[model samples]
Every structure is written in C-alpha cells, then in structure tokens.
Target: MKKSLRTRLYACLWCLGMFVFLMPEHTNAQGAAPSEHLVFSFPADAVLKMHKVKIVQSAYTEYFEMNSFTSGYAGLQQTPDSSKGSSHTLISSLWDPNTSAGIYSSVAYQASNTYTGRFGGEGDGYQSINPYNWVMNTWYNQVIRAWKSNGQLYVATFMNNLSTNQWFHTVTLAMPAPSNFLGSGNDAFLENWDSNVKWNGAFVRKAFFKDCWNLNTSGVWQKHTSRYFSANAGDSARNGIYDRAFDAGYDSTEDAYYMVHGGSTTPGAGFGTGRTLTLPAQTNQGTAPVITAGVISSVTASYASGITTVNWTNDNTTSPQLSAKVEILDAGGTVLYTQQDTLPQKRSTTFMATLSAGSYTARVTVRDIFNNLSAAVTGSFTVSGRGTDTTFYKFKNAYSNLYLGVKDSSTANSATISQYAGSNSYNLQWYASTQSNGSIVLINRRSGKALDLPGSAQTAGTHPIQYTVTNGTNQQWNLVVATGSTFLIQSNMSNHYVLDDSASSTLQGTGIILYAASGTSGSANQQWYQESVSSGLSSLSGAAVSAALMPAPPVTASVLQVFPNPAVNVVNITCKKMNAKMWIWFYDVPGRVVKRVAVTGSPMQVDISSLLPGTYFVKYGNETVTFVKE
Candidate 1:
C-alpha cells in the first residue's frame, strides 16, 4: 500500500484543507476550566423537519470572568461530514465584554467562530452593534432561519433583547450544502471559552429557555416540546463542555415552555458532549369557554314576625335568560339556602326564607355554557321581629349600646342630641311617622321636637339636634333595614351618609353625628337596633313638663331663680322642674367646674365659700346662668 512522494504530499494537502474547512477559530487555553453547555435537541432527522428555529433565554446573571466569556446559541446542525468535513451553522448571542462588548449577535461555523475550510480562511461572523447596554440579568430572544434554496444552503439570524423589546439583524450566511448533509440537529447551547489562554475562573451563569418553535418549509409553526439528554465531560457522545448544571420543564402557568439548561462554572472540566432532555407525557385539552358577567344587582329584604322576603335584581339586559346559582349566607357565613335558577334578569326576583332574626348576605354566581364561572356578586340584609314593626321606638347604637337622647329633654328651636347609657330615660323614645312626602320624621316624645340637622348641613360629622318641626327636608330620614335586628338610619338631607356616633365612641354624651355609609354592614357605627316603646307623641305636651325644653325667656328667667346672692355659706337654687339626678356645675372664671352639687328638688341648698370665687357660672341641665359668691 506504499505510495509515491507526490501522492503523499497531495494527501497531506487535502487533509489540511478539510481541517481548515471544518475547524472553528476556537482553541482551549491552559488552566481555563471547560465550559458547561445545556442543549435542547430534537429528532435526529430534525434538519429535514425543521426550516427555522428560535429560543428565548433570560439570563439571571451579570458578572463574567475577566479572561473568558460565555455565550448561548440557537442553531441547526447535522452529523459531521467525515469525507468533506463538518458542515453546520450556529447563531450565537454572546455577553463578552472584550470581543462582543455586551449582548451582541454573531454567526459561527460550529460553536465559536465561523470558518470556511474548503475556501480557506475565517468567515464573516459578527454583525450588528449591541444597541442596548443589554441589561444585566435579563432574557434575550434569538432566532435562526435555515432552508435550502436552488441548490444552496442559507441561514439568517435575528436577536431581540426581550427585556427591552428591541431587535437586531445578524449576518446571513450561505453554503452549498443540502438539508441531508446538515450536522446533528437544531439545538440551544451555552459555551464558555478562554480567549486569553489563562484561567481567570469563570463566574456562575444561568438562563431560562422557553417558547421554542419550529417552522417547516411551508411556513407553518409548531411547538418544539421534546425530551433532551444531559452529559458531563467524560461522556464519549459529548458535543460540548459539561458541568453540574441542569435543565427541566418550567411546567407552570406563567411559563409552560419546558426550560433549557443552566449551570455554574466547573474549572478544570473541559467542554464535553451535548445531550437531549426528556419531557413528561401529557394529553391535549380543547379551548376553554368565554368568561361570563355576574348579574345580581340590588337586594331588598323585609321582615315581619319570623318570615323574611328577599328580593334582588339582575341587570344583564343583553342576556336576560342567563342562569345563575345563588346562596344565602347567615351572619356567620353559613349557607342557609342554595339554588340554581334562571334569572328574570330585568325585574327583581324574589327568594323568601324563614330564619331567626339576624343579618345575612346573598352570593350570586353566573356560569357560561362551557361551565366557565363569572365573578361573584353579593348584597346584605337583616331580619328582625323586635321593634321594626312598631311605629315608635328608641334606637340603640349596636357598637356603643347607647341610646339616642335629646339634651335635657329640650323642645327648643335647636337642641343638642347625643348618645347616652341611660336606658330608662323617656327622652330617648322617638315617634316614627311617614310624612306626606314619603320621608320619615322622628319626633322626640319628651321634647315634642323633631330630629334635625343644625343649619341643614348635610356634611358628614355634623351633630344632629332636636328642632321645632317644620317638615323641612333637613328633618326627614330614611330607615334602611339591614342585617337582622340592626338597621341604618340614613338622613334624607345627606343621602350618602347614615346616623353614626363620631369615632364610634362608647363614651356617654358622645354627639350623634353622620358618617359616609359603606357597602359592608359590619361597621358598628352604622348599625342601630330598635327598642319598641310608646306608639305616639300626641299624648305628650311640652307645657305638661316642668322643664321647658325651649329656652326660658329672660322675663321668665326667674323660673330657675337663684336666691341668696353673695351668700356666705349656703346658696338655694329654686327651680320648679328640678330632679335628684339634675345637677348644677359651678364654674369659675376660667370655665373649670369648681363645684358640682346635686339638686334633689326645687329649693335645693348648695354649700359655697369653701374656696376662692370672684365670678361663677352655674350650669343646670342645658342652661348656664351667671351669679357671684363671696
């Protein structure tokens, strides 16, 4: 088998030509650790089935080694051509600070740099400037299109920084190879190379690959969900460097595209072979139904005895026949009634149930033909037989347990109203009567005065008062039945707010005010329970009471005449309407109460001159009269 010298020389030249054609401008340096690669592979005949390939890899890293750089690529490859050498093209997006600068686009013959062995030197590789500073720790999308045209192989590469939504066109390359002559298969791979011949130690890097697709020559895209293999440097079938890094399917709602591999650098471990990963089996499901609109609108409930009739409306006019499932829940969220029914959808539909007196909420849900459920709609109501059926009653704040009371049982033009803990006070009783205009007027039995808003201020926090009945809009109120036993006392003057104690205070004498009404009935300040009492205030008269609810005229100011002015020890307070609980607060010039004495009855005696006093103000009930004592 010996050959002539000329033949041997020719053979050597042919081998050199093949090496140049198949070789990458890549060379491993001493002390540099081998780069690990995560490769997503397809069928061995993937080159024939695929016309284009794409991958999106989001890097969760920023730092790169000083002397070496790492890159991830999406490309088409087939088995190496042993006779004419390897023929494969790869598009690489590199994060090299020195060569590529930032995330830049480049084309490669294999994994590193483009080469032309048959034609002789390095091939045109890098193209397009890295437009963005290429944000660190972000994902970038890369694509490769490959197809045979008129007896020639061509590849066009494109890249986009997904984080920035910017794209750049890389160089397109051509070769005279056919699809059958392509190397291995389409793959996504990461490579680390030492450009300076020294191991500066590579930093750990990781990326996520998702939303991969394959386009056939007919221009149809199909999902590329396939199994892949993993390997280390020692495997004989290795195509790239291998490390301890790995990849698996993202397998979640946010990202369903089985992710590719990522890893930390393993110095001294050279690049090994590429491996394919395997995917779990799954069955396909059809498209889901469209979303439906929830329809329940207003809810009105009325209770008499123990029976409560609940009525609600659905406003979906476009679909009047829409069906919905309804559930009535008690105050504790326990389901009391559940029904699946077709909604009238226009007028109000009624649902009646007999239950103990308490608050309850209605839950409505609609479903489309495909069983897709809509968002839930809800409303609240109450059922109570205690005092709502009566015409006259006392109202108690559910949160403070305080009764609404008129100041000093006043029948004045304007008298303060407050919440107090006095349960036996007749001044707390009110007559509820519907006026001719359909508004309710609450007349205090003790004062014969109506509940009013001073100055007719409809603003929140305005303290309510007792005023002479004029049937003005400011004196009208509405009783809105809420959760069982409790109701919302809403003023017709301020339709947006309800009667409430300021700051939900439980302290006695806290002024009863108004607050913005909320959708939920859980707030204590808005809930009031009624206590059945006398039915009419016609039997009560302001003159029959000793205390003039109205301010005493100055001519009759002698009604509370104080005797023994400049008294040495005892001062007598003569008032016809005095009671034991009624007291006089003696205040000094500084307005501080210096002494508080109980008035057991008319002509009560108070001991003074116990301390210094120049001028004093005596407060009896709501009236503050001035006197001096030595």
Candidate 2:
C-alpha cells in the first residue's frame, strides 16, 4: 500500500479519506473463533501462505442456473463489470489475472492513480489487467481452496508486512512461532497481526500507516513503514527497513502466482543504509491464502448403467494422505464430477464414477508435500441403471454433474436437467444396487419411468415374455464392466446387468438385472453366477422364452414418494402423468432407475423433493415403488 502519487499536494490532501474505508474479517455462523494464524514477518526469510473455499452445496444444486458454465465465465468474455449484461457467473478454476474477481458495476472506480484511486476496490488491488496475467500457469489466477482433513493437510503459510497504505484489519490467530514470519528459517511462525497489514494510507485518511511487504515467495512489495511530514509537525513515517532477499524461496515451481507492484516500478532503490528508494511498494490483497488440517476415513458409492461410483479415505499428519481425489457437487458449490483414484498403497482411498441415481457426495480430497491440502471427506450416493424394465432413469445432480441432459418427463423441474463439461453424452457404465434396506434405482434411456416410485410396483400387459413383480426389483437390469483397483476403471460393484431376451449372451437365456452382487468369474457379464441360475429366471434379455405371469397382477400404479430415504434437499415425486409424457424415476434395489424423468405431462399430483431427498426406486413401465424424501 505504498501508493504515493497524489501530486496536487496529495490531492487537496485526501479526498474524503479516499472514498470510504473497508474492514473485512468476515465469518459466517458456527463457533470457535479466530485461529486463522500467520503473524509477523521481516527478513529472516519471508514466506507467507493461506487458501480456503468452503461452500459446498451438493444434493443436486440449482439456484438461478441459466445453464451454468463457469471456471469463471469460460472466456465468453464480458466481465469488466458487464456494461449491463451477462452473469451466470460462478467461475474460478483459479485464474483471473486482473478484472472481475467480485464487485462488478461495469468497471468504474476509474483510476485517479494512488493505485487506481486507492485499490479500485475496498482498499485496492488494481482494477483490471491480464496478459493471461503471467502465462505458463497451471493454476494461479488465485482460486485456492485446497482440500483434506482426516487423511492429512497441515499448511501454515507466512508472508506478511501489512502497514504501508493501511488496511491491516485483523488476521489475529496464533499457535506457532520462532523466526518464520519473513526471516525464512521455517519453524512455521504465524500469529496474525492486525491482519498482517494490507493498507491504503490507513483506510483513506492517507497515512497513519501505509503498509506493504511480500514474502510468501515474493513478487514484490517490501517497504514496511514511511512517515511523510506533520501530524501538524511531528514528521513520522515509522522508519521502514526489513527487506530480506525477498520472496523467501523454499522453491516456487509454478504456484502460478507472482507479483511485486511498484517499487514505483524499480530502479536502483538503495540497498539502503540511509539512501534507499527503489520505490515499488504498492501491492494488493490476498486472503485465506491456504491452510488445512486433517482426519477422515472411509466412504464409497457406485452404479452401473446410470454410472456412478465414489471412494474416500485419509489418515492425516500435516497433509499426509499424499494423493486422493473425488468430487461431484451440484447443489451450488459447483464442481460436478472429478476422479483420480488409487488405493492399495497403504489403504487410504478415494475414487468416483458414472454417477446418476441421485443423492451424491463423495468430496474426499488429499494432497501433501508442502503444496498442502486436506479438508474434504463427504459421502452420499444414489446411482441406479442396469438395463431393462423399459429403461429411462437418467438423473444428474451433484453440482450439475457437468450438465448431462434429459429430464423432461412431466416437468417436475431441475429445469429439465441437461448440462455437460466432461461429456461424451455421459454414462459409460453407471450403477447403484442396494437392498440392505436402503433402496435406490433409476434406469435410463431418456426420461419418464413407466410406473415404479412409491406409487407402488405392479404391472401387467407388457408382461408378455419377462415382467413379473412380486417385488424382486420388479425384475432387475443394469450393466457395464471393468475392474482392478487403484482405480483402473471401477464399476463391477458385484456386477449384474445381463440383458438378451434371447438376444442371448447364451448359457441361460439371459434377461438379467439381479441386485445383490459379489458374483464373478463367469464372464459374458458373470452369466448370473450360473449353476442352474433360477429365481424369477428370464436370462436372455428375453422377448419370449419365459416371462408370463401378468393376467391379474398390475395394480400399484405408483408415482412418487422419494423421501429422506437418504436425501439432502428435496425429492418427492408422485405421478399420474401431469401434462403428458412422464417417467419420474430413481431406482436401485435391484429394479434400476438411476434417476430418470423425460417429463412432459403435469397432473400426477406434484411434489418433487426439491430435486433430491434419498432412498429411491420409482419406475414407470413394469411398475416399482419405494419412498422416503425427508
């Protein structure tokens, strides 16, 4: 905050204390105050750090989604504050360079200088500029939230010198000290002094404290203190002088960040015994820099046909787990689907997949070795989609799951769900088969189930060759296979999806969907674990051979009951075909409906659990029902 240059004798000497002062040390609810840590620093070595972003809204997010797409606007451009337009904005896969990090009225704040007339913001940070900002970046436009906690993530950033143009609000949190702040010995000293200072003439009054210093691996800012003339004539500037070799290197291999705003721009600035004045010192602000602590263990999910499989595990010791990744958020915290799994090394795990059914949350994040990260270990899932009973359960949530598409059946809303980021039309192999009481199934082809959903599972007519529901998943169906471990391609969750209806894969006819896994070694999709393989037998995806019993059956007519059957925000579907074309599904419990909708009609007597509740299994074709939406 050195920002000198008022020139006209400091512009009438300070226009309204530089347009209102700002003091932000925000916190939203919950308990345990202050502990943000990172206090004091000077030459010893100078390195400071911090980064966090906790706002994960999963359970199928949607609050004003214009068809969301953000890694911060994905370069469609605009944002210089929008002259008056576009902004579905939720961007930041880290990388902004200069403009649009927040406040956007359309750019204003002009720039009377003093570093854009005092931070151009709530205390300044330049307003907008980007050469992509610095290029070669893999991740550094500053979007750090670093994850982990239970598997390891113990970061302690140190890079502070606030006090120059004044805005040291308060970063007071302490716990480790002994020459680490700026001097660079690395015992990890972080205490929190008036927010480690980042000022602007002390909040516009123009200089009771100017502020400037950078040592989290330097890009520039040094200066410390300065006294320029009379408090009416006391002439005090604090003396200034504590500049280590700078950015205190512990080695910075592409953190993607680097800056040193104005030694006035640099030119000879005295190594100073008395001389000193290379000028520079103007710097902006950087918060929550990066800090995480750890301790979780275990969480899993998977699905076939509708695709979805998740994993997690971490043990913790200052960012110990080392490698772990899994994400699928949609309630609004964004990030829908991200997988990089590996297990067997020392156990600790995390992996996710195809994902459909509904209720999905497998955050699990880990990273160690100084890059620090660990503070995420969530688990929730619904996935279901095996093969038959008509097929149409395609549910996509968990932070928009990148926009998968197709949810139009009678419009219960989710805006008809169609989003994509990692797309190839999705679903390579999705699944969710559970029956230990939990329940879940949602098939897929497009949308609209034929019956199955708390409305009750019972069907007839289409029972010509297969269909039969005394309730063995009404007649299961689901598929896709690949296995190994460290995540080569998981999705056999005990495997079962064999459809043929005589379209045969051979052995025993073949019209399968089963439910209860752990069966293998057979191949042709585990041939139903053969051995005569009876039990509501159908086998060949059938068209004829077996399926008969449908004379008086068909009586459930179900529509929706999706309750706290394991839910998260609101999922209660009941159907009678409101407007027209319908199929409100969410299956698993053998049946299969990984989450479908195809909506078109309307009057089924509405009530769609805000998109997600839990424990589901609602079909439309051969009928199926099971509820719980709480």
Candidate of highest lDDT: 1
The C-alpha lDDT values of all candidates are 0.46, 0.26
Against the true structure, candidate 1 reaches a TM-score of 0.26
Q: How many clashes would you count in candidate 1?
A: 33
**Alpha carbon lDDT of residue 448, candidate 1?**
70
| Model 1 lDDT tens row, 1-630 | 122222222222232232222223334322222323233333332222222122233221111111101111233222122232332222222211122222112222221123322111222123211212333345554445444433434344444455544444333333334444223334433332222222212333333444444443433344444535343344211222323443444444424323233334332222233333454422231122122344455665554542334455644321122346667788999776565633222122233223456788877666522223666777787766442333357788878888899876667867888888846566888866444333567878777789998888888788888988766788878665443235678888745478887888999888888777777453777777766665321122211224433224322222354433334466666554565545466654322245766567755778886945334567665445555454
Per-residue lDDT, model 2, residue 624, is: 50
TM-score of each: 0.26, 0.24
Write one digit per residue (lDDT tens) for candidate 2, span 450-556: 11212222221111111112223432333221111000111222232222112222222122222222233122232221000122222212222122312123334
Tell me, by TM-score, which candidate is best. 1
Q: State residue 510's C-alpha deviation in candidate 2, in Å.
A: 8.9
After superposing candidate 1 on the true structure, give the runs of residues whose Cα lies further than 4 Å from its correct spot: 1-133, 147-150, 177-184, 195-202, 235-277, 281-630
Model 2 Cα shift for residue 112 (angstroms): 38
